[model samples]
Target chain A: TQLLEQSPQFLSIQEGENLTVYCNSSSVFSSLQWYRQEPGEGPVLLVTVVTGGEVKKLKRLTFQFGDARKDSSLHITAAQPGDTGLYLCAGAGGSEKLVFGKGMKLTVNP
Target chain B: EPEVTQTPSHQVTQMGQEVILRCVPISNHLYFYWYRQILGQKVEFLVSFYNNEISEKSEIFDDQFSVERPDGSNFTLKIRSTKLEDSAMYFCASSVRGGRGTGELFFGEGSRLTVL
Candidate 1:
């Protein structure tokens, strides 16, 4: 079975600090997506990276797909209290069904 | 922006009881899915529906679980008999092009099911 392993299961940082979360998998993926979920709500899509070595930016967040397509990363610049949430990385393989990572819980204290 | 919606934000039921969770995916979406997340656990895929049928389902979707798209917009998941392990937040999601292209899945707020 395909699996995505996320790093830094829990992170706590002061507002304005920078942080990075990583997702790795032993299998290749056609595309990878990043989502941020708040309490009592579903995960909100942040970005989807398709091509290997591709990078996309959304305001303070930057997402990168590894050259091998087996890993991905999310970097937050100057995190704010609003950025605190559970971050999840999911990978799409041969089928449309997604394989999700364990997720990273981020806490940005103001 | 269009979004997926689920009814009964929370449902409490006893073990061995039947429960049906309803969802209305985005009107134009062609693919629908059901997922569950146990408390403090990662989200897991339960089933995927397309073209009025289930295209895929996870191992977790056993004999007791069933999915149906009775109409154009509504998709439902029914559990014949609930168990304490079934307690979790069930999410409904939809995508226009199955993520093969640029379209991403839109998920509902989710229905929290507490099986006693």
Candidate 2:
């Protein structure tokens, strides 16, 4: 079974603080995707990293795929209240179906 | 910009009742999928549909669950009998291509299902 485990399942920080969340797995994947889901909303794709050791950024968010393709991480710089949401990492293997992580709920307090 | 849309934002039904969730994926997209997220849990893949047939499905999608693209625009997921475990936020998504290329899937806001 392919399972993606996320660390720091919940985080609360004041605005402007930086934080990092991680997703790790025992299975290597062909591609990894990061998504941010606001309360009551579906997940929105933040970035997709395909190549091992690949890195991608979107505004204040940076996503990194491990060299082994078995892990990934997301770093947020100077988080704001607007950045509060559930961050999800999903890994795609040989098929289109994605294996999603449990997600980290981040609360950026003002 | 186009987006996927779903109906019945929230539904509450008694256990053993049948329910059908609907979705209209982005036009021109070839692949469709259904996923669910239990409260405070990770999003789980339920099934994937393409070419008017189910391309893939998870163990969670058992005999009681079925998917159909009855028309060019609409996709539906039907649960023959609902259980408490089936209650979750069901999300519909689509991708222009399979996961290998971009691996980007566009998701709808989701329909909340509650079993009483």
Top of the candidates by TM-score: 1
Each candidate: what lDDT?
0.93, 0.94
Write one digit per residue (lDDT tens) for candidate 1, span A1-110: 99999999999999999999999999999999999999899999999999999999999999999999999999999999999999999998867678889899999999
Worst 10 residues of 2 chain A by lDDT: A90-99
lDDT of 1: 0.93
- Model 2, span B17-49: residue lDDT tens: 999999999999999999999998889999998
Against the true structure, candidate 2 reaches a TM-score of: 0.97
Best by lDDT: 2
Q: Write the per-residue lDDT of candidate 2 for residues A8-85, one digit (tens) a residue.
A: 999999999999999999999999999999999999988999999999888898999999999999999999999999
lDDT of 1 by residue, B13-73 (tens): 9999999999999998899999999998889999888888888889999999999888777
- True-structure RMSD, every candidate: 1.0, 1.0
What fraction of the native alpha-carbon contacts across the interface, defined at 8 angstroms, is recovered by model 2? 0.83
| CA shift of B42, model 2, Å | 1.3
lDDT of 2 at B5: 99
Docking tier of model 2: it is high
